[model samples]
Target: MIRIACLIVMMMAGMLRAEVDARPDARVAARDAAQRLDAAARQMDKATTAKDRVKALSETVHAYEDGLDAMRDGLRRATVQEQRISRELKAREIEISRLLGVLQSIGAAPAPATLLHPDGPVGTARAGMVLADIMPGVNSEAASLRAQFEEVTTLRLLQKSATETLQKGLVGAQEARTALSQAVADRTDLPRRFTADPVRTAILIASTETLEGFASGLSQITDAEGGAPLPDISHRQGTLPLPVQGQVLRRAGEADAAGIQRPGIVMATRPQALVTTPTAATIRYRGPLLDYGNVMILEPQTGLLLVLAGLDVVYGHAGEVLPAGAPVGLMAGDPALSGEILQETPAGMGIGSGNRRSETLYIEIRQDNTPVDPELWFETDKDD
Candidate 1:
């Protein structure tokens, strides 16, 4: 019965260890993300046209971002698991010491003495039965301890190697960003709905103080009365992707930190993150306006407008018709250095935190010059 109880405990310990090992491998995820970055880099190199280069570089940037995110997450898990294993080992220190001593003693005993007892055959038979039952439990514990030590070693190595991985990703992302900016500047293939009148635009800006007033008067900036109709994405209402990668900071009509409210959605994005047009649209205006930093006003369809603000650099010109996923702008803020990222991100491993996404992109949808909630048109849950 004592032997049976020891066997059961051994089985339970094995099961618990298996449960701990069932978690997804962090290193594997990081490796896969790195491969994606490699592929994107090759694609960027092979690009022939300005548009293709822009697309490829955009993909490369995304790949590096994903790889870095994976790296951070992997390091965090490794650190946590290493700490946990250390604690477990420390807690069982005395038990393991006693176990080693017992094993040493068993090995040192003579073969005959190990199997026999002074009381003779009956006593020896009882002693043999106890040893058989307890040996399995002892062996299982020793194996578990060995595994924990090996895992700790691996986790430490992972953390040490992460710095190099992070540095490479940061350099790759920056290069891609530089190439993307040049590509956008050289791009001239997009169709034009109409050329903007800078004098009229200046007049409109001088006349309007509010976004509503400016939007309502946008038609006066250009003389084109009925430009080519844009693709109708009316059926895609409530399913359009956000212009940039980010989480929704505030929904339409939600008051901000100062209790000021606006009929637009605020998205928190990483510094220098690429902003693409969700659908093919004609640019109406691009530049600073009112209190908004830098804004891009797009007309997706007649009577329907999409306003994206808070960009550091707005791409394309007013009246240029862009296809879906075209480079529109970049969110304001410099990319965090790789060293800073490694030092600051261990405590906050997620990309949704303010430390990761320091820039904000404000989006608003207007129909016939009336502001409407952006959530009604965009797929906000994609970030979640």
Candidate 2:
């Protein structure tokens, strides 16, 4: 029975790990966020306008927010595990009563004699019957004791790690939030694009009935100011670079788990990976969109636009002429395998979390507001 129970625990543990293998690691997340803060600081140093400064600080704020959120979740999950262990310890105390009684009476002559009896027919038969009745209780008590010790140790370690992460996140978030506030307060150095009529653009975005209409409206607003230098990207067909390094999980028109088929490529990438432009492009719009997280729309030519979405942070704003390979943003992820589930499992994992997010990027190329296969313009050798 002891062996069987141990086997059950082992199987359960494996299943838990399997489901959470996609979880971002805590330490890795902390480290990645710290690195991102440095990058944002550098960008802030070079920012000449209020919009640019705000863009840099926005990255910092996003990194801090993600880190703080992950740390809080980790701490919360660890506390729940500690509570569960406490409950198990209490249950074990009740379960061991019979085993404890047997142990106390082991010094009695009959019990000891029967347990230590030689293998003769009569003695062996009597001993076997007594052992059968006692072994299960004894084995169960031992298994529970072993499991309790291990559980306590694991909980303690998890709590300690979470505490450290929380401390780091708190410090980072505070500093970044302060800097972001200061950056936003500066209105004297606002850029021309930021000074543009935002109400009309907002109205256009709000009134657009479809993505094509929205893109077309954006193009009207983004029309090159008569003499702005185009990036000459129209010639780079069937060989444009990938925006970020990742494995292609889905091609254009592939139906996803949500049953929505769209003209885009979905790529699974590592946590906090750097997202960049494949060619020099003009930032038409970069910000949050409904259900897409952070999205960036960049135009490399007059009628063509590249759309990249599902990021933790975006680095540029509208009207910025981004050079090829310029960093656009960073994706979500951490180095550790941590699960964030919206509902509780049988084992009580993710009992109080809000949602689970998968790190998959969606890329779409639009030619004059019409969706087209991105593979035709991207390097075939690169993640084809």
Candidate 3:
């Protein structure tokens, strides 16, 4: 009976030792899983390309989930072990109480020799020894369980870190997508057609006025004498002058089917192109007139009316004399006929008017309030 009791005690002690030794392995496995998960999350953060980032994030999420599941499974197993150990400890405790009760009834001390009592056969003796051995085993198992719990908690913290990192990567990817989409939209181009006929007409009309003569004429008009001296008309006799040159999409007379009457001239250039003018002869005016969207009239001298229209910016003052080729302002196509001009010469001259494709310049030469065809005054074959 004593031998059997010794064998049972040895077996219980072995079970307790095995449980305690296994705890370190569980902790090591949990730590390894956390390391893998953290590494995957970091890789996801470094990915820059769209496809690569997507792949990396997917891998990272999978790793985190897998690690979390592994940790949960380990915790579950540990909990089951804990419960089993607790139940075994309780059963042993109840058996010990029964033994104590038997000793009390017999009026004897609860001692190891109680196993030798008449009712205590070999089985009872072995059971008493097993209970005693299991007590130390239960204590060791409790300590190991506490360590495993701590390891599981650490794993949870690592999982949270990985989850946050993954979320940040997703946000960054979304922002990049938005930025790229906007960039493409902003760079898109619009359809535009260049009408060479209008451009040629604008250039031709701009070349008819001489900058030197205009400047000289303006100076004479602003003099204090009320009537200024005229320049030597002989010097300007044969030279082809630069007329209204900036940008003339429409002429100064007549209207087509669109009810859009032509303006004197239109200009669309930068401020640098404007001519220098004397302050005394600068004139400023603004109002709706004919085909001109906004008109500015600057009469530098008597009998000379300088009209500026379709302007986005005007710097001339009233009574100021601006030189020729000065930048007046910008002109857009008319809203009525989309800024288009008809090109056709009048019928009485030798040149057939119908042969001309389009007449963009609507020029009229006026001498002392009487209007005349500009073609008769201007040399037609001059360089455009």
Question: Candidate 2 at residue 32, lDDT?
Answer: 52
The residue pairs in collision within model 1 are: none
Task: Report the error of model 2 at residue 78, Å.
Answer: 4.3
lDDT of 1 at 356: 71
Clashes per candidate, residues 3 or more apart or on different chains: 0, 4, 32
Task: Output the lDDT of residue 305, model 2.
Answer: 90
Q: What is the descending lDDT order? A: 1, 2, 3
Question: Model 3, stretches more than 4 Å misplaced?
Answer: 1-255, 259-291, 298-301, 332-366, 374-384
For each candidate, the alpha-carbon lDDT, in order, equals: 0.77, 0.62, 0.38
Q: Give residue 194's error in model 2 in angstroms.
A: 13
TM-score of each: 0.86, 0.48, 0.25
RMSD of each: 3.8, 9.2, 33.6
What overall lDDT, based on C-alpha atoms, would model 1 receive against the true structure? Answer: 0.77
lDDT of 2 by residue, 149-262 (tens): 676676656656555555555555455545655654552442223222466667877787665676778855543354455656667788777877656888888898999898
Candidate 1 local lDDT, residue 187: 79
